[model samples]
Target: MSSPVSVFTPEESRAIKQSWKALTADGLLPVGLLLFERFFADVPQVRHMFSGTGIHGDENSPKENFSMETLRENDKFTKHAEGVAAKLSCLVDNLDNTPAVMNICSELGQAHKMYNVKPEYFDRLGGVLLDVLQAAMDVGLDHPTIQAWKKAYEVIAGATKPYL
Candidate 1:
């Protein structure tokens, strides 16, 4: 079977690199936190997982174990998000390095699978994250930027397909 990485085009790869530069130049770490807050808000049960708690099947918890304060200015959360962004930036920088990129994608996919994250959840998270990036870049949905993000997400989704 063709790997998910096969879906990306050269142009798409370039766009991802440009977008990553834009995001980091504008402080993506904080913006990432905001994006994740909204993304997990919809999946309340997932909050604990990000908080270092293992995922539990039940979804009826009334109170979230972690608060925004726990995430804000938290070194661990900051480091984690920064690591993810860094990995993503590396993927963009080495877009032509298919082997390395594919490996990272596969690892991410497996991690998501362990978290029981669904494809739809990824879709939603992607949308929100892109929105955060767009706002951070202070650019509307320009064609090139959006296309790059689309390609990036496609690659990630493809990587995560095994887990899903």
Candidate 2:
């Protein structure tokens, strides 16, 4: 149940912990919403996948009618977004526990696979996430923090890819 080696250096771990704390200080829901907004805007091709998620107004409505308010008001969508944020928090909390991190990421991978999420989408989303994190940071996501996040993402994706 244990990974053979740790994935993060001490400095990287500290950077990640500090930045994540700042990033989620307000709450996961807002961070989740911001992530979705960026994801939907940056990856329009993924819109169809969210059609049934009530993010695009309603189940039968066109995506062009999408609104932040619609997503905010939709309990299901909000919960889904919250779930995403929660999972990231789990990973961050378990940073020192490689097995837990692997298991978490693996479960995420399996779930996304069931959703028919493409492998490439993970890579694309990772980039968008970094951008969102950087922009969201008022104190600035410094070099070490960025590198830490990138490496953590690589580990997450690596573990997640097998199930995908």
Candidate 3:
């Protein structure tokens, strides 16, 4: 089969790969925790969706009141976040292989659909990922590198939404 056409420019792919390397240099776990932490902070309403993940605190407690510490300490949540980070790594590693990227995202979209993940949440998570990248990286969002990440996320979201 012919390789799928990539929407990302070669420069964008390089920027994304470089940023991913820098972002995960410490390890994927911290980046994953930070990503989800920011996601929950920015979109507390979605916290309920992650109930099965064991990241949030007591169900009886107000959703907004759950301690972030609970999420940080939960093994299941940590593993889940790490898995997400790993998927991101896989995507970056396969940037030149557009079909592989689409396949990974399509599978994720299907899986998340089973969990009742909404189409809007994908954008929210993408926004959170960008925020996390900006905050964690020495270079902020204004840089071309972050801009490239933004483009990469758009591609991922676009590819995944069809399966959602």
Candidate 4:
């Protein structure tokens, strides 16, 4: 699908992509862990949502079973987080390709909607992500960077909101 009216400027897109790169360069797994840690901790009850069902990225893994319970420290979880990190990486990398990026986000929203991933959860996830990025980055997250991420997220979440 085509992207909605552009919500971000070229400068904003650059900042968002830079922030993503900085956060995940050599610490994708740890950063993902920290983000999910906050997500599960802040919304403890949501952890149960993955008790029986696996997290989003275990479809073709070598592991037979997967759950978020021990995922905070498990390799499977790291792999899982890597999958998501990779997706976000792709999206950020394609920031200039508006149609492709929006389409990907829309598809992702649809996929998550199958599991009842709601719009609010995206916002929560974004906040947790920013917090983790802020803590992880050497210079730390600045205002422009945060705004860039927020705008990028709004595009994604807004696309996903329809399914939610």
Candidate 5:
């Protein structure tokens, strides 16, 4: 199906690609995890829903086990978070492939809908991510880069809006 959102402008796409590359080069996988950390920090109750498994802290610790109970209780939020992370990673990796990017965005949006993820959460996620990026880079996002990131995410969000 055709995407509901317009394709990103060439400049926006380049900016996003550069940012993703810079992030990965800096040793962060899926930069979205930074946002997830912030999101969970703000919503502590959501942490209980997440099995500590597949998530790591700065210090060494045994992996927390996953359980169906956690899934059943917070499946929507957890699944959407996981899906968004995966989709963003895929987009970064397949940067040259428009179809792949669109597919990931569509699937991400659909997953969010199934998980009942709120639209407002997307904005929060983007905001937290930008904050994380700035901190990680030790500098604020330049205007052009910020605009590109916002534009790219907006396209992703708009494409996925139908599923939500």
Candidate 6:
């Protein structure tokens, strides 16, 4: 039966591990930049999620927007991505404990619900992340590698959705 997330085959897991190793050497900044770029481009409303002020009221700046240029220069963006990479690495490193890691993702996602994060953002992020991974790695990442990331994203997103 089809599910929100599927268990990766041993081969797929191996491919994902190799791809992630290359990505680690390259750093997560590029990946982070791509994430914010696609996020802002596809769902501009999410910009307020990371800003200094809330989405409404005079305290909010109407000019506030997400930009690839800005994301590059933004330390917060880089740092946030680094943290994400670290956590994701932790999860991937311990794929043997899939259920535990997934629980962490669900808890984290639920915690963000206080910030008014929507399930759709998780969906959007999953798709854009896959696009970024596939695009950035080019020929180094074959179809099976891409599929591994896709499966991983689905698990993360699916676990997150219930709390949102």
> Please, what is the TM-score per model?
0.72, 0.87, 0.89, 0.76, 0.62, 0.78
Candidate 2 residue lDDT tens string, 1-164: 85545678878888888888898999999988888888888887776776667454456677755766777888888998888989898988888778889999889999888778988888888887889777766435566688789899888988898888
* lDDT over C-alpha atoms for residue 7 of model 4: 55
lDDT tens digits by residue: candidate 3, 1-164: 87667778899889889889999999999888888888888888888876776444456985456776877777877899899999999999988888889999999999998888888899999999898788767677788988999988999999998888
lDDT of 1 at 100: 72
Candidates 1 and 3, the one with greater lDDT: 3
User: Each model's number of backbone clashes?
Assistant: 0, 0, 0, 0, 0, 0
What is the per-residue lDDT of model 4 for residues 1-164, given as tens digits with 9 covering 90 to 100? 96545557878887887777777777667666667778876666566455433444455642233334557656655676666777788888877777877788888888777778767888888777777666655344567777677677777777667865
Tens-place lDDT per residue, model 1, 38-115, is 766766665655645322233553336556655665677767766666666766776766777778778877877766
* TM-score leader: 3
Q: Which ten residues in a row have the lowest lDDT in candidate 5?
A: 62-71
Candidate 1: where are CA atoms >4 Å away?
Answer: 1-10, 26-28, 42-45, 53-66
Error of 2 at 16 (Å): 0.6
lDDT of 5 at 151: 64
Of the candidates numbered 2 and 3, which has the greater TM-score value?
A: 3
Query: What residue pairs are clashing in model 2?
Result: none
Candidate 5 per-residue lDDT, tens place, 54-78, comes to 4433344421332333432454545
Model 6: residues >4 Å from true position, as ranges?
Answer: 1-6, 53-63, 139-142
Q: Give the candidate number with the greatest lDDT.
A: 3
Q: Report the alpha-carbon TM-score of model 4 versus the true structure.
A: 0.76
What is the alpha-carbon lDDT of model 2 when measured against the actual structure? 0.82
- Clash list (residue pairs), candidate 5: none
The candidate, 4 or 5, that scores higher on lDDT is 4
